[model samples]
Each structure stands twice: as C-alpha cells, then as structure tokens.
Target: MSIAKRLASQTAIYGVSSIVGRVLNTLLVPLYTSRFVAAEYGIVTGLFAYVSFLNVLFTYGMETTYFRFANRPGTDRPELYNRVMTLLLLTSALFTAGLALLARPLMSLLALPPGHERYAVWIAFILGLDAVAAIPFARLRLENKARRFAVIRFANILMNVGLNLFFIVFCPDILSGKYLAGLRPLVEQLYDPSIGVGYVFLSNLAASAFTLVLLAPELLAVRFRLNLEPLRPLLRYAYPIMLMGLAGMVNETLDRILLPRWLPEGFYPGRSNLAAVGIYGACYKISILMNLVIQAFRYAAEPFFFAQSNEKNSPHTFALVLKWFTLCCAMLFVGVSINVELVARVFLQRPEYLEGLSVVPVLLLAQLFLGVYWNLSVWFKLTDKAYYGAYIGVAGAVLTIVLNFLLIPIIGYMGSALATLACYFMMAAICWWLGDRHFPVPYPVARLLIWLLVAVGVVAVSWWAPIGEGWGRYGFHALLTLGFVGLVAAVEGRRLKAL
Candidate 1:
C-alpha cells in the first residue's frame, strides 16, 4: 500500500473510537438543549471549559512524554510507565484535594448559581480521574492497542450518555408519573429535581470514575516506584509541551469561558449573560462536527508524520495528506453550513439556540483552518522545532483573548466566533510561512484556497437562496452539497486515485 493509503486506514481505525463515540455523546445535545433553558444549560457549558483548562494542568504533557521515552530502544517501558503514573497520581491527588477544599470559594468566584456549589467538587474528581487515565491511555496508543482503546472509550461515552438520559430524560418522566410508574418511588429515593443541571456534572463524574476503573488494570500493574533520575528529564521535556497544550486549549475553549462573563446584560434582550453563554455553547456543538473529524485524523496522522519524517518523498506525501484533508474539510464546511438550519432544528431542542446559529458556519471555517494548521504542524514536529508550536499556540491564545474581550459585548457570540476564526486563520498562515523555510512541504496552497473560496461562495449562495425552509430548501441544498462532492470527484478523480 502507498504511505498515504496506510495512513488513511489507520485514521479509519482510530476514528472508530473518536467519531462513533463522540457521535453517541453528541446525540445527547438535543436532550440537554431541549430539557434545560439556555441559562441552566450554560452552567454545563461554562464549568466544562474550566475543567478543560485544569485537565491540561493535571496531565501536564506526561502522556506525550510517556510515548516518547517508552518507544526508545531497550528502554524499560514498565518502569517508565510506573514513574509517569506515580507523578500523575501525586499531582492529581494534590490538585483534586485542593480543588475540593476550595470548591465553595471557586463557586463564588465563578459566580455559579446558588446551591450549585457542589459542581466545583464534582469537576475536581472528573479532572483527577481523567488525568491519571491519561498515561494509561497513552500507553495503549504506544502499544498499538487500538481496539482496547476504542472499547474503553465507547464504554465511558455510553455510560455517560446513558446516565444523562436517565437523569435528564427518564427521571423527570418518572417523577411526573408519566413513564415507569413502578420506578417513581425508587427514583424519588435517589433523584432530586433541584439537582436539575447538576445531573450533567454528576453523569460526567460517574463516567470519569467508571473510565478509571476500566483502566485499573494499567494501574494495578504499576510498581508505584518514583525514580528521580528519569523524572527530572521527563519534566524538562514535558513543561514546554504542557505550555503548548494549555495555550491550545485556551484557543479552543476560552470563548465559552469568556462569553458568560464578557456578554452585556442587555445583549440578548430578555436573556441573561449566562443565557447568552448557553446559546453560544449550544450552537457551538454544531460546529464540533468539524472538530470531530480533525480529532480522528489527528490520532492517526501524528504517528504517521513522525514515522515518515526521514523518507525521500515525505514532503510530497505530507503535501498530499494536506491536500486531501483540506478538500474533505472544505466539502464538510460547505455541507454543514448550507444545511445548518435543518441541522439546528434536529440537533438543538430550543429556538433560543438558533439565535447564535450564525456562529456555526464561522466556527466550522475556523476548524477548517485548524485542520490545515494541524497538517502544517508536521513541519515543527518533524524538524524538532517544538518551540514554534508553543510560540504559535501562545500567540493564538493571546489573540483569542483580545478579540473575544473586544468583540463579545459588541457583536455577542459572533464576536467570539469571529475571534476563533481569526486566531486559527492567523495560526495556519504563520505555520505555513515558517514551514516553507524549515521543513518545506509543497502543499498545494493555491488549490486549497480555491476550495475554501468556493466553499464560502456556496455557503453564501445557500444563505441567499430564495427557497424558504421547505422541502424546496432541502432539495436545493442537497443538490449543492452533492454537486460539490461530484465536482471534487470529477476534477480530482485521477489525482485522488494516484494519492
């Protein structure tokens, strides 16, 4: 098989974990948006953004370090694993304890809804559990244990989704004596209506704990030995990576973090700032369709990039990867944007979420730029110029913060969406420029930009299409989406086949 084809197969396998599992989780979006109003659901959205930040803090690049050192010739893999887990265990324990102790204070500072203070403590455990599981999950990846990884991931997602349905959907019905009358008394004993949005956090915590239990075998085998010799070098190698990951997370999620605090009270008329946040966050899920694809591609592409770094045709192969990857995303970018009204209706349960629906296309385009940036990132990763990634990510995070603060109050979430688009667009541009000088890949820039332009034009055309929201709109969109696919196939059939 050609190198590119091999990478494609690997991506498909890895995607079973990411795509399918996340789709299942994504299906619950309707339940949350439908059951809870924007203000209530915003709590789930806002708190998770903080959890994402602290998650990076807890893991701190050890996962990547484990894969690096464990893969070395004649390295003591088991010993290395134990040491990494020991560091994680210690740090996570301290952090979780600290967060639990400061839960009430954090609740106050975050301006969490009254009586929802326990969310701080719940988030701490979720972070702690996920953090310790990081190295083991990394170990699975390094060992090429893809199926094992997929199974564990699916198990966690299923458990989480199931609990969410039970808590958010079925429990309420049971309480109202509408369904499963026999279970009303039992659910009454366990479920609390006041726990309303808290179930989201509780469900997530249960899943995290369940995930850790599934990974317990990885833990059980560890010796808990802390050899200081390797620990110093590991931390040295890891801290920079930690910085990059933390910065990148800020770019990805800081908007959700900022939207509630930054939005003005009169922003959405009757809606509070938190309500505006809820709307932005819910609409953001539609854009995640693009992110899910990027994530699956990344899991397969990262190792492939490193492995092919020394090949004679590596640059050309890398270029082809970016070409096809960009083409796929451009098609998706157009498809999702054109049919988004239908998508919003299907995926979102509240019309309130539709207010910020304009953000979906912008975010989709941002994720497209992000995918290109991911492809270009190979330059730094392969050339051992990791500092460039750190620099670009930190710069992007700074831009995101500045743009968000300047834009949210003026344009609401559109400002946040545009900030994300601008941040990633800049990151991709800078990465491509630096990459040409350092690890030059002959990426078909002109062609890729044309695809993006065409995609934008098509999306714009769909927006202006006089066909109202009827079967006529659906049919018109289907033609445009399918027409784009056919165009790509007809134009690039031979080239795509050659790749």
Candidate 2:
C-alpha cells in the first residue's frame, strides 16, 4: 500500500479507540451535570484542569523522546525502553508520594473547600498512575500493536463508565431504598451523598489503576535496567518538549482554571465562583467532537511522521496530510457550530448550563486552529528544531494568560473562548512562517483559506436564515453539511484517486 493509505489505515484503527472512547466519556457530561449542580460540577472541571498540567510534569516528555530515539539507527530499543520506563516509574512514585503528603496544603492553595482535600489525593494518584503508564502506552504505538492498544484503551473507558454509573447512578438509589435494602447500610458507608463531584475523581482513579494492571504484560516485558549512557541524550532532547508541553497545557486549560477565580466579584451577585465555571465547563464539552478527531490524528500522525522523516517524498506526504486534516477539521467546525444548540439541548441535562452556549462556536474554531498547529508542529519535530516548538507554545501561553486576565472580568467566559481562538491562531500562523524558514512543506494555504471561508459562510447562513424548527431546521443543516462534503470531494477527488 502507499504511505498515505497506510497512514489512513492506522488512523482508522486508532480512531476506533479514541473516537468511541471519547464519545462514551462525553456521555458522562449529562450524567455529571444532571446529578450535580453547577457549583458541584465546577469542582470536577477545575480539578481536572490541574490534572492536565500535572500530567505533563509527571511524564516529562518521555513518550515523544522514546519515539525519537527508538526509531533512530543503531539504537537499542529494549534498553532504551527499559531506561525510560525506569525513570518514569521513579519520578511518578516520588511525585505521587509528595502530592499525597502535601494534599492539604495544595487544596488550600487551590482554594478548595475544607473537606475536599481528598480530591487532591485522588487526583495525585490518578496523574501518577497515568504518567507511569505513558511509556508503556507509547511502546505499543512504537511497536505497531494497534489492536492491543485499542483493546486496553477501550477497557479503561468501559471500566470508568461502569464505575461512574455505579457511583453516580445506582448508589444513590440504593441509599434511598429503591432496591438492595440489605446493602443500603454498606453502600451508605462507602458512598457519600454530600461528596457530589468527588465521585467523578474517584471513578477516574479506579479506572487508571485498573489500566495499570492491564498493562502489566508490557510493563514486565522489559528487563529492569537504569543506564546513564542514554539518560543524558534523552533528557537533553526532552526538556524542551516538556517545556512546550507545559506551555501547551496552559494554552489549552488555563481558561478553565482561571475562570473560576478571575471572574469579577459581584458579576453574578450571590453566585458561587464555581457556578460560572460549571456553566463554561459544560458548554466546552460541545467541542468534544473536534477534540476527539484532533486527538486521534495526533496519535497516528506522530509515529507516522517520524517513520517517514527520512523518505524522499516525506515533505509531500506531510503536505497532503495537512490538507486532508484541514478539510476534516473545517467540516467539524461548520457541523458543530451550526448544530450546537441541538447538541447542547440533548447532551447537557441542566438548562442553567446552556447559558454559555454562545461560546461553543468560538471554542470549536479555536480547536480547529489548534489541530492545524499540531500539523505545522511536525516540521519542527522532524527537523530536530524542537526548541522552536517550545517558543511557539510559550508565545501562545503568554497570550492565553494575558487575554484571559483582561477579558474574563469584562465579558465572562466568552472572553476565555475568544482568548483561546486568538492564541491558537497566532501559534499556527507563527509556526507556518517559521516552518517555511526552516523545513518548508508546500501546505495549500490559499486552498485551506477558501475552505475555511466556505465553512464560515455555511454556519452564518444557518444562523441567520433558519428554515424551521425541530426536524426541519436539522434537515436544512444536514443539507448544508452534505454540500460542504461534496465540495471537498470535488476538489480533492482527483488527487485522492492518484494516491
């Protein structure tokens, strides 16, 4: 098969796990919003924002470093894997222990309530377990164990979903004497009705622990070895990626983190800070479709990019990938933006959470830019100009912080969404300019802009001129979606056939 065909095949396999897993996880949003009030759900959202940041620190860029080194000529794959795994295990253990010890102080720093320190503890363990599991997961990708990887990932999603149902759905009924009268006392002892959002974290902790157990085969396959020869080169290469990862997290998640604390006092008089956070967080889930596609592409693209770096037509392949990726993301942008109201009504249980629905289109567009940035990022990674990636990320992070501070108090969560869009647009644009200077790929910039304009026009038309309500409006939107798809097919059909 051709390289493009192979990449498409791998992406399809990976997408089965990523798309299915995320869609299932996204279903939990209604479960969460329905069971917990806005303030309570806010805690779940805010804490996981911190988890995104901590996870970067815990893994310390070792996964990408492993891919870089393991694919190089004359490298010892087993030894390299063992060394990286050992380092991750030691660091993760120490980090978890330290977080557990300081859980109380950290909770205080986060301004969490007095009784919620255990949330910190559970999150610490979750990040730690996931961090340690990173290398083994990357090992599966590097070795092309896609089916096993999908099965393991799907299992974790299933376990998490099951545990969530038990804790959030069934336990309350048991406590309320709906059934299992004999088990009420034991269930009551374990499940606290008052600990609303804590159950979400607890379920995640259980899932992460279960996943670690499932990964024991890969974990045990490598002999325990901690050599220093590879350590120096690995760290030297990975530190910048680590910094870039941290900055990227800030760009991606800082809005959720800051919105709760930074929303102007008395903006909503008598409202808890978390109420705004909860609404924003719930609305953000509207963009999960775009996020799922971006994530799956990243998983497949990273390894593919590295493996193809030395090929004669690698740049051309990368260019083709970027074009198709842009088209796919633009389709999602238009689809979600046009149909967001329907999605919000169906996916989110509480009417109060729907107040922030206006932010959905902006956030989806931001994510599209982010996906493009990730594609542009390949130039830097493949060219060994990783520090450029760090620079671009830091620039975006700074933009995110400054804009969030400036705009959140004035315009509420809409400010956060706009800030995200600006930051990502700048990052993608800058990366493109820099990539041209260093390792140029003939990305179809004008063609992509035209596609984007067409997408925006469709969304605008749907917004301004609705045909009818309910099924009528949906039918019109479906026609528009198909129109965009047909446009793409006509434009790319010849090239795809050639491939």
Q: Each candidate's TM vs. the true structure? A: 0.96, 0.96
**For each candidate, what is the lDDT?**
0.87, 0.89
- Name every residue pair that clashes in candidate 1: none
Clashes in candidate 2: how many? 0
Per residue, candidate 1 scores C-alpha lDDT tens digits across 1-499 of 8787788887887788799989889888899999999988888888888887889899988876676666556989988988898989999999999999988877765577567778888999999999988888888877767778888988999999999999998989988988789988899988999888899999999999999899988889888877788799788778877888888889989998888788887878899888888898898999999999998898777767766776798898889889999999999998999999889988888888889888999999999999999899888766556778889999999999999999988999999999999999999999999999988789999988988898898899988878876888899999999998899899999997776
**Candidate 1 global CA lDDT score:** 0.87
Residue 189, model 1, lDDT: 89
For every model shown, the clashing-pair count is 0, 0
Stretches off by above 4 angstroms in model 2 are 179-186, 466-472
Single out the weakest 10-residue window by summed lDDT for candidate 1.
Answer: 64-73
